[model samples]
Target chain A: MTSTAAHSPFPSGRAVPTPVTGGRGGLLASVVGVAVGSVFFLFPIYWMLVTSVKPPSEWLTSPPVFIPDRLYFQNYTDALFNWGGLKGLVDSGVVAVSATAIGMVLGTFAAYSLARFRIGGTNLSFFILSLLFMPPVAIGIPMFLFWSALGLVDTYIALIVQYLTFTIPFIAWVMKGFFEDLPVDLEESALVNGASRLRAFVDIVLPNVRPALVATALLAFIFNWNEFSIAVLLSRGRVTTLPFILPTMMESHYVLWGDIAAMAAVGALPVVIIAFLLQRYLVRGLSFGAIRSE
Target chain B: MMATRRRPSRWSGGRRFALLTVAPATIILIVLSVFPLLYSLRLSFTDQQLLSLVPPRFVGLANYAQLLQDNLFWSSLGVAAAFALSVVTVQLGVGLALALALYRLPRYQQFIATLLLIPSILSSSVASFQWRSLFDYSSGPLNYFLGLLHLPLLSWTADPRLALPSLLLVDFWQWTPFVTLLLLAGLHALPASVFEAARVDGSSSWQILRYQTLPLLRRVIAITVILRLIGAFKVFDIIYVLTAGGPGSATESLAFYNYVQGFRYFSVGYSAAMSYVSVIIVIVLARVILRYMERPVGRPAADVPVAEAAV
Candidate 1:
């Protein structure tokens, strides 16, 4: 057997292997499998897009209007402008951007320290992210009371405060991984050149991690943007955001699919766009530095 | 670079900048995450409802005691355990299959990968509504399509037994893609030669997948499973939207139960107790999985020798 055909020991960093010979049958099966998997996987979002454009008459048709003859734009407008919808958009946007900024600021500092200072063991960074398992809902009751006590309930502060539960840890974890790939020599050279440590970090290290920062910020913001339970319980409808308000719209009998779809279309737009436009960074982030490590 | 040449004096900018950088994140983390976690633990022992102005009366373990006796508690635990295991198992299994299948493909890997990720990235709330609609009895195409096959039409959400499964199916659909994406990345990272050599030795695709692919994919699979399961255990919006934990409370996971106790009924103390019980359980489970998933390479403690001494 050829060396090219023999398995390489290295798992990652391989050139895309040439397609194996005479495996069309297996490859064909794989395509069918992906088709089957992706349909159920993607159908809901596809349905959301489809419904967002469907005429009102097709909303609950028995057989379903898998295709709609006329696309409507009214739902998008009404949902965005009517019934505090615009306010919801502003609120979600504010909370997301604020949380992302705060999380990145705090998280970057911690991550850079951990990376450069060699604060703990090599794996300490990984262990820090282990806290990811602790669900935010676990603290919902205490936080609800705590925020109420401080009279911070129903405010942007509450949203930011709540968002840190996940985002802080997330930002720190991802940035630490990104920082690991940086060589220590640059910082050392900067220190040797009489540049202060802070300057070296800001000038040299921070610039290189730009892509990871953007990825982490976008991801953290999206998580905050789409958060539901905390938004519902903490803010009530007074501080309601898209996720909170969308559920309320669903509970009513005369659920306007068009309006819901319209808002969802707009709500999901930023994230879907980010998920695609920043695919390289997003994929790297979602890989969470695991696949790359090998 | 190997050693601190100057001992970086205490008043030095390096020392202070490092300290300052560490402080903000640590402070926010403790205040936001750790403090609240402990407060919830404290409230678990006392009968403290938020709205009631009266000082929190020390109930001393009564909340935990109540949880032990609450039938709903046990039921939700059963539901939670079942949900977590089934969802994780099926997701990992199917995801691995899909990933291996995709790795064999000649082209469009990025497109295929993106489709796999789209499901998880969509708003969980909307997905829940769509699933609810898909399983709707009267006019849903799912039932209509199944009806033509001479199958008995059944109430998916309305039935107590079927409700959790209905929720699970939706979750499975959304998250399997996530596991696939993660695993595919792992598979793509794996060296191609191992499988090629296995084939040279006359190994079948099944043999290569089992011994060569699966073993190499183990660490990543373990990580993905733990991450996904943790999320599964906290499932909220989908269930809340789909069944509201109904059909006679059949679908209430610990999350749903905590929400009702804390938010709807305003039994703040009771909710706090449940919260602690859950946080402790989840944290313990997380630690256990983290330990098992990452045992030998957990070199943070091992790296402590040089770093702490330098400090």
Candidate 2:
């Protein structure tokens, strides 16, 4: 139902003709529109970069310095080393990687079962999909309390487990879609040749779904990395993530724009790059397999 | 080939393996999500305080009763509703327009769409900080730009009147691209044949869009709106960073208010009640959206053209 065959303008081995009606005026208008929109979308990112390099004096200038007069490389180091920024980044990284790895492993096994065996049938898939609709805040407070009672607050395990509530379901659903699209004959033939089901799955199905696995892991990592409310509620100063730290940084007695900008830029850089590099899969992942653009 | 000997054991073994594979995820989800839900529901009925030395006691409907009477709770709900409504409306409008424009410009479609998605992908906290600096009264780039344009520079975050709108602006900047991408995906999924037929019949572009494209896109649009609405309802990080729901709680959303109640004020039971109310609201919205999804698109059968209906 969500296949991109008809929607994708650039289908494999086929070229779609540009519609013939629009004239030069239309082309010019499209060009101008795209240019203006790109600037609007890109300006803040550009500003973050420029502001990160600007001297402290230029941060609050009357006519805001569009470009820094001198490069202040200290901002990056200061933001990273001082201000507890490195700790935040490290915490975020550890939680995200752990959650992604765990979710991927669990999801892959479950998805393979669901796809190949039709275990629990179609209603089960729908049930998993329903979990995606839940607003995180509804369960966030309770989970916070639960973690606190267990003496697990401010621990990586608490965040990773919370992250799994969303990621595992997502990975299961998306990977199920991917598994269904793969040819079943290869695995079946292997089974006929006396390979154990697990062995065949390990040797045959696993390699075929490598790309999907990577995409799912990347998307899950980004979600965990960018998550805030759970991180805020669950972690006190001990395991503060970048998103939680950014707000505290803003609330400091003296606002340092350069440091904030540098930290923000650095914090956002990895995910932004990953999103761009894996744009196609990211789009597919974002849609929850409802729009399989890939 | 020894087919019969291997078949029975293999079949049962496969079933057991499937069960084993799915068990861990199911157990984890239940422990994390379901247990907490039940726990919170129980907590909401008791007057539990994190900092207080008093033992918790079941108060039946007292917390819910208090929640209904609390002006702050009501205001936060109203703020959340208003915020969600406004943000979803603006994002839908602007996102649809941008999607349409990008659809028209086939050459730069991919590049521009990717560029526009940057904000949506960035951490909300990061985006909030970027906008917070932009909305800064004295030295912020926004006011400076307004000054250059010879327009009055308003205090964006500090003024109660402009605070919500300022936050909305930031939200619009961050999430409109998300809507745009979804709509674009929907547009791509549209059957090209219908548009071609409409053009062949000399239907105007506006007419084709209004009749054919929009009708076919009903489900996609509904899904996008529902997702955005839910997201807007849960908004916390941006509000926390940008205004901290400040100017005397003028911009406090339900989630942010609950966070404040539970963490800052240490009113555990009251916050659990608030979270349940938020969940109930989301459930209602989801039900309505699901109903819309189940309904047939466009007008009823009697109003349809016979030729089109035949298909």
Candidate 3:
């Protein structure tokens, strides 16, 4: 019956009661459960890291080397310089950053409206939710034809614009939830002082929700960085994103396993770092802000 | 309901401001969704060929007619449905159990939770690559471990019988943590007084879990299921990486088949029609789920008003 849990921004925040006193057996079961889960989860990432640093001789060998004796940078060199990893990294970064920037601006603006004015009510919100369910193929197919027609194929604009389809809705929805939970008094006071609504939103309301904004933006960035289907469909040779090109490396006849691992390691690095940084917001971000963690 | 409440100009300038702010994103979404759909619908009825010298000709429902008879279409639909169903069910069950176990832990809960998130954060391509090495036919660590135990070696992705299951295993490895994370948050957020009252009243642990925990966690469970099912239905990246829907179309999901039809063959009309059919299926399924999500789940004291206004 202690009240020492962390403070939460949620309106429903409460001091979590102590965990059920399940005694020694329960603690033992809990530790065992986590150990089992951790192996299933972390071992693959370990394999990826080990594979990236493995020499060519070790990569395809039977009884794959659990640990490489010495680190090899050749795979990393070939992946970055010879293959498209460097280009993929730059392209993916540009696209993800651009999309995240635009998405945050447009999505935040729309979310504020939806939260405060309840614009179009649940109908608008539902429409946005439905977009998330629409298959990427459905979007990708037509986008391919349209972009090809406009001669915009393999362009950053094509990928960024197409990314907006998902990003806008996702960011808008998550931020809307955050905005809805905020007290209206600060913004109202600003408005009553003859400040414009836009000014009030920018100065008073936005600063209050800064943490949520940062969390939502970072998650949107990760989503865009990891996007594949749209990238593959919209770009081929010119604007090759990391996810799009990794498969080509795999499908090539030679199949440089070490190089592929190196590229994947490089590609997955940013998102993993961000995930650690956003550990507190991990559930909220992944769940599109439907579940907030204390 | 208080007459003393100073109603801000919610009806006058506020509505206009809302419309102005929301219009750009809303219009963009509508245009992007509707135009492609209508254009794709138009293309669906025509024999449009991207690589052909022959011009497109209107084919009416010929594409749809052919789709109904196409064995690949039927099989791919079956694969996608089964894959989605299996992954969602397994992830949910295992995730819920893991959440319950972690919930009882008195320490190190946050550290473990953070570590479990590593897989979900990685892109699908990287995850697939990791699994590919693990599932390598002759030299994989999996077979090596199996060999140490004197067990028979199994070809993971190459064998037709094991291909889908292998994909499922990779998916389970990558995403079970996500489901677990959501459910754990839900568990942590639950008001503990109810459980206290139940225990004080002499309720057994099993009875408390069945009557109290499950019902309270229903909304979070539903959200987790819906999100996972949606991702599962559109599963393409992992399939493309792991199997390329290979071993003679044994692993081709609907999205993969659509890719092959459109990109590989340049059969634009047929692909467009297939896309529409899949969209229809998703829309229908989403409509049902969204309706469920919108319904009032029990809200706490401060949540009720905000929930009503937001919904």
- Model 2: per-residue Cα lDDT over B1-311, one tens digit each: 13223333444458888888888887787787778888889989999988899999999989999988988888998899999999889999888877766766655466678888999989998999888778878888889989989999999999999999998988888888888887777766655566567777887656776787677766667777887887888888888887888899999988888888888887778888988887677666656554432211111212111112214
lDDT of 2 at B269: 84
DockQ of 2: 0.41
Q: Cα lDDT for residue A46, model 3?
A: 84
Complex DockQ per candidate: 0.40, 0.41, 0.46
Candidate order by lDDT, highest to lowest? 3, 2, 1
After superposing the true interface residues, what Cα RMSD does each candidate give? 6.4, 7.2, 5.0
Instruction: Compute the lDDT of residue B160 as modeled in candidate 3.
Output: 93
List per-candidate RMSD values in Å.
5.5, 5.9, 4.0
Error of 1 at A205 (Å): 0.7
Q: B19-114, model 1: which lDDT tens digit per residue?
A: 778778777777877788788777878887767888988899898899999999889888889999999999998988787666655356656677
Model 2 chain B, poorest ten-residue lDDT window?
B295-304
Best by TM-score: 3
Per-residue lDDT for A272 in model 3? Answer: 83
Better of 1 and 3 by TM-score: 3
Better of 1 and 3 by lDDT: 3
- In candidate 2, the residue pairs with backbone N, CA or C atoms under 3 Å apart (3 or more residues apart, or in different chains) clash, namely A7-B188
| Candidate with the larger DockQ of 1 and 3 | 3
> Which lDDT tens digits does candidate 3 get at residues A1-294?
021233333212212332333446755776788889888899888888888989989988987898999999899999999897899999999999999999999999999887777677678877888887787887667888788889999999999999999999899978887787776778778888989888999999999989989999999999999998888788768998888878788667766888989999999999988888888888878887666675
Q: In candidate 3 chain B, where is summed lDDT lowest over 10 consecutive residues?
A: B297-306
